[model samples]
Target: MLENEFVTFSQNFLDRSGNHRSNQKKINEYLCKNSAQYLIYWRGKVPVVSDVRDQLCWVGRDHPLVLNYSGMPTFLGLENDIPFFSINISSWLPGNYNEAAAGAFFDSNIYNHPDLPESSFFAELRGFMNRISAREAELAVMTRGINVWQENNLYCSKCGNLTEIINAGWQRNCVNCGAFHFPRTDPVVIMLVTHGNNILLGRSHGWPDKMYSCLAGFMEPGESIEAAVQREVLEETSILVKNVRYLTSQPWPFPSSLMIGCVAEALSKKVLIDPKEIENALWVSREEMLEAFSGNNERIYPARVGSIAHFMIKKWLSGSIE
Candidate 1:
């Protein structure tokens, strides 16, 4: 995939992450010196925008800010001279000065209001991702994922005991059963399954009408990425896929997920739509896909740019998926 070259923290959580000690010290110096770092806080899937940091403060959701990193400050070890971890706050920018300020900061539905700078935060971030050093974006993604995972997994799954942040917020220790839990990355298979010159795609019920992308689903307990691709295709659209091949992946931190993109050859073209999982499914031909990409196809739309689905499909159109 052409987008494979983008910098991502695929190895950030690996065993050798300890090598980042020196790097953390440096990043910490920068963050602490600044008035406040750009923080991404979420209320469910919607992110709360801090329109003005001048009047903003973070109150820990329950407890005061701690260095544990589990609730938000779990030290993410170190990265050179920078120390990066997560931070959690109950709410953000409590008193609103202007409703227009909301959309100017973050483009979220809950925080969306008119009168603010009219710029979508996600769009701005996407522009930054496309231009800035990939390392910066990678760091931002990693930081958000770490913070979200720690905030949600506060208790032990087995014994229902409260878990404490450990290993610099990378691991959680169960007080009752001595269980150590690590940050989790749920694997999702996103595949562009093709038959001849047509690619199979589907959309869920709540998605915008005619907005279809690659078929995707969570990996089963013991399923491999390739199996997930085939299984998801069959289950959702009854399209049997063969010759599955890996392409690339992206860390989607909307609650911590790793989207694994792949390309698969379709063995059967029959579409037995599974209404429970998808609102619609179809096989769009190469010409039609090109038209969709160019915004000329009115019946279907391509996946949003910057997404793994878009990356994979673009690769195919460029003859790189081979």
Candidate 2:
């Protein structure tokens, strides 16, 4: 698949040296030797810039502000021969300001590091993922996902005790009960279903006006991916699907979700919108979707540009789907 067709957070240029994750002595050595570059993450946003229009710049090894980190940086693997690390700062980092009413956590923490260049400011991961290079996007995606996990998993679930960082910040140990817990990643299935020349698209209740995309849902326990696709499509749109096939997946790190993308051939086409699951469901013809993709249609739009739904729809339109 072309790199442009990938959903955000799917590209990784870093060589995740799993070899060092469990080796504390080596990590400490790297940290002490001043050979480590850093990615500063605070409440899920990172500093980014394009340098050129519609591009993203990678966080550098020699940025001056990296000198101020006192917190123990989390291991993010190595790029080239230099070790890369990430530091999680408070929600209000050095130059962050308070906002009156920000909707999500991302909006709550738009920061500007004091030492960064004027052209670079902290941006929410999603806002700039589309414009950045694969390496830049991967850094933000990996670090943001791990830090968000750390934030939510500060306490042990079983013993109701505080957990200590272990395994180089990847796992945590409960002090009171001596239980070990690792990071969490929820799995989701986002699928494209097609019948004849039309694709099944559904919109949630609060989605942008007239915007629709592939029907999706979480996979239940004891269910296979193909079964989940069949069940979710049937439940949401009353559309039966067969011949389900897996495509590429992406890490949607708003709170660490692995979106497994798929395509399924529809067995039945009668539309039955499940108000409980979706607001509206329709069969969008390929020609009509082509118009929407080209921005010729005013009332309806396909999925957002950086989403798996958009990728699948475009691939199908281009006759590239296998």
The best candidate by lDDT is 2
For model 2 the TM-score comes to 0.89
Model 1 / residue 116 / CA error / Å: 16
lDDT of 1 by residue, 1-322 (tens): 4457642433243222544433546444544642323333333221222442112122222323333233434444434533444454434443443345333423333333232223322123332334434554555566567777777888999898999875545778899999988889899999989888888989988676689999999999988888898899999988788899888888877658898988999888889998999999998988999999999999998887667788788888888876
lDDT of 2 at 190: 88
Worst 10 residues of 2 by lDDT: 50-59
Native-to-model Cα distance after best TM-score fit, residue 132 in candidate 2, in Å: 1.1
User: What is the lDDT of every predicted structure here?
Assistant: 0.64, 0.77
TM-scores for every predicted model:
0.74, 0.89
lDDT of predicted model 2 = 0.77
lDDT of 2 by residue, 132-230 (tens): 767777877888888888888889999899988877778888999999898888888988888889888999986768999888898899999899999
The residue-level lDDT of candidate 1 at 26 comes to 47
- The positional error of residue 48 in candidate 2, measured at the CA in angstroms, is 0.6
